[model samples]
Target: MDEIITRLQRIENLLEHLQAERVSKEFYSIAEVAQMVGRSEYTVREWCRHERVRGQKSRVGCGGTTEWRISHAELLRIQNEGPLPIAKRFG
Candidate 1:
């Protein structure tokens, strides 16, 4: 009975530690973000090229190669903003 109580207490302590730890959501790569938004990777690249949105290079995973990271909040903002309007010219 005492051994079981000790094991339970240990488990409770571990759970508390886990609950206290802060876990951050990792930024997604441009390709991953493109797929997430249901658009081609090139289109995302173009957006970045035109400065339509902000992104940065982040080294995630192995190989030490940096990839473009888009903020989820920024993506949602862009999505909410909708597509750009077409320009009209008058002669």
Candidate 2:
């Protein structure tokens, strides 16, 4: 009984550590975020484009073009809560 409880506690600790390490990254690409959130890459990209989520365009290479990169904190927020509020655009 005591041994079983000890093993359970150890397992829980390991799980917690793994969870922390999972999001310890500074940023995540759209594909990675999509996999984590169980959504399509296109969907995630669209979210970035629509300003539904927080992200920034990062330079992928020496080229002038850039791609979206989401921060770890934003990813956590999206997982726990949801996307940010929709902003009303004024013409």
Candidate 3:
């Protein structure tokens, strides 16, 4: 029973490490965000153009396309806000 408990603890530690690594490595591209929120990439670009979505800019894609790296926190905010008032449609 003690050996089983020790193994379970080790597994728990491994799971925690994996979760941390996943969070650190996780990054969403513009297209990914658009798909996630059911918007168009063009709309997302427009929002970025108008400073709608607040996030840090990051380079993405093989050709180094510029993308706004919206963190999970910002996404939650946007979700709660229920879309930008003026902007009709999102990408």
For candidate 3, the 10 contiguous residues with the lowest summed lDDT are 82-91
lDDT (10s digit) by residue, model 2, range 1-64: 9999999999999999999886578999999999999999998898888888899998888877
Candidate 3, 20-69: lDDT as tens digits: 88663245556777887889988876676666877578876799877677
lDDT of 2 at 37: 93
User: Which stretch of 10 consecutive residues in model 2 shows the poorest summed lDDT?
Assistant: 82-91
Model 2 per-residue lDDT at 71: 96
What is the TM-score of each predicted model, taking all chains together? 0.52, 0.69, 0.54
Candidate 2 runs further than 4 Å off: 1-23
Predicted candidate 1 versus true structure: per-residue lDDT over 5-87, tens digit per residue: 99999999999999888453456678886877788998887676566667777786788987678877767766788433432
Off by over 4 Å in 1: 1-26, 60-64, 83-91
Question: Tell me, what's the RMSD of every candidate?
Answer: 7.1, 3.9, 4.7
Sorted on TM-score, best first, the list reads: 2, 3, 1
Best by TM-score: 2
